[model samples]
Target: MGQVGTKDRFELVGTPPDHQEAEFADAVREGLSASPRHVPARFLYDARGSELFEQICTLPEYYPTRAEREILEDRADEIAAAIDREPTLVEFGSGSAEKTRHVIEALIARHGHLRYAPIDISRAALEASADGLLADHPELEMVGVWGEYARGLLTLERVTDSPLLVLWLGSSIGNLTHTEALAFLRDVRERLAPQDRLLIGVDLVKDPAVLEAAYDDAQGVTAAFTLNLIARIARELGGDLRPEDFCYRSRWNPDEERIESHLEVVRAHTAHIPGAKLEVAFEVGDRIHTEYAHKYTPKSFAALAADAGFAVERNWTDGEARFRSCLLAPR
Candidate 1:
């Protein structure tokens, strides 16, 4: 955390005292010990995984990024006007904060200056992005929170009295199941004042073929992204696993209204992680569920907002309706 001159400022917010390595080991052990083993999608975001995801966004099949960016580009001014005067902009999972530039510029134009708070689990990404943003926008002041959504929100001390605008863009909410999403939204609602606004990006239900292709791109960047989780466990937790032992698979689950990503064991294998003191045996065809991307229709999302104590104020979408950015206020 440092300040440059009078214009640029940055602060790194620390997480709770829990050691990250111990937490990762515990999560891995608990996840693998369960029947129908699964890992939380959040673990898929190590440094390498983050880089691969940036590549995934540029792929032609991945429509969410482009569609969401389109809406932000077209409607940032309107979004800023809705929030009105100087407001502290808070973004969740603000990786690289590339799409954030539009909204930041719009806010700066409407008001005289901008105060931005970006919450992210990766300290490296947060610091790097914050530096670049600070260098670029002299009118901006930023505090980078190094924690997950709920924890970050709890740690976020109010920086400005000008109303709060929380941005959860890139459809990352799709990572949570319906019930989990509701609970998470409720937690967020509890943290906000009644007048505070939330603008969230959500991927829309579309052709199953399109969804499937997006997850399993021809270039195999998404595949590498999924496998990187295993590599991460091995690198960080003393797990003995080779990338060749498993294959990547993505499927459109119409019944679930989501796309599922899995790492299927191609051959019988045993993974031994000395760090966690755990051994896991996998037979051929045994799959580790890695991620889920849930797609929502407008009606479904509106109902979801209501259940979480938020009233949908407005929703902007791309021409193809592949994605949506909805504005909501606590009911």
Candidate 2:
């Protein structure tokens, strides 16, 4: 029901928080110096790199996309009605904003007005999504909060009205360490007006095979996606990383209940990070751990939100029940 009209020029308005770039650089430096297999999950999304990831979602083994899409296709209206009224749609780490359209469309069907805001570290992504969404739904006024999710929360004061619905979709929240996730949601709860709500997508715990396949698809797209982080560093600060020197590995960490991605060194070598003036050594087969995707259960996710001052109000699942979309309200 979102108004479709002539496309308007979309503006990309923001960049990473100044300190973020510095911190990211430092993390990379420290990570490189510490071990052969250390890489940050965040560096995986440069312009071209991000496009590769969208391709990753369509690979047959990637279940989150298909699972979440099924839930939206079947239950978007039910999901929309769970929220009480018209609200600004604010999405954290909004990415290309594809999944968001489902709920946004449903919201507009029930309520004639909407303001769409997406927060992402990549200005290119935000602008691209805003332009597409604006063109498709002229009734939805799009805004981009161009910063890391936590810092972007600082800009929430710019939105007004009650029952604001903030979205944290695509199982991206799984990237955070448990402690970090709790602290972040707590900060978000503190910033909310009383009637505000949060809708988050979670990848559910499943068979080890299914979990492993999602990250380490047979097509190797996910592997290529992981290695691109190295290419990103090479281009960013003039670092020279031989992409072939590192290989991607994804494995289930049963003890931690997560899937971990690592970059393993194929040979002993040294790489130069020009900006940091650092020569980092790598041992053959040593792994620089990059990311962990923690799968969640209904109880665990609800508990995590509750600990952060939220009450789970509704839950939506796909036909396969492989993923979950949770709607929570401020306590």
Among all candidates shown, the one with the greatest TM-score: 1
lDDT of 2 by residue, 261-325 (tens): 99889978888888656788778888888888999988889889989999998888988889998
Q: How far is each candidate from the true structure, as Cα RMSD in Å?
A: 1.7, 2.8
**TM-score per candidate, in order?**
0.97, 0.93
Give the alpha carbon lDDT tens digit for every residue of 93-118 in model 1. 99999999999999998997988999
Full-model lDDT, candidate 2 = 0.81
Backbone clashes (count) for model 2: 4
lDDT, model 1:
0.89
* Stretch of 10 with least lDDT, candidate 1: 1-10
Candidate lDDT values, in order? 0.89, 0.81
TM-score of 1: 0.97
Residue 153 alpha-carbon offset, candidate 1, angstroms? 0.8
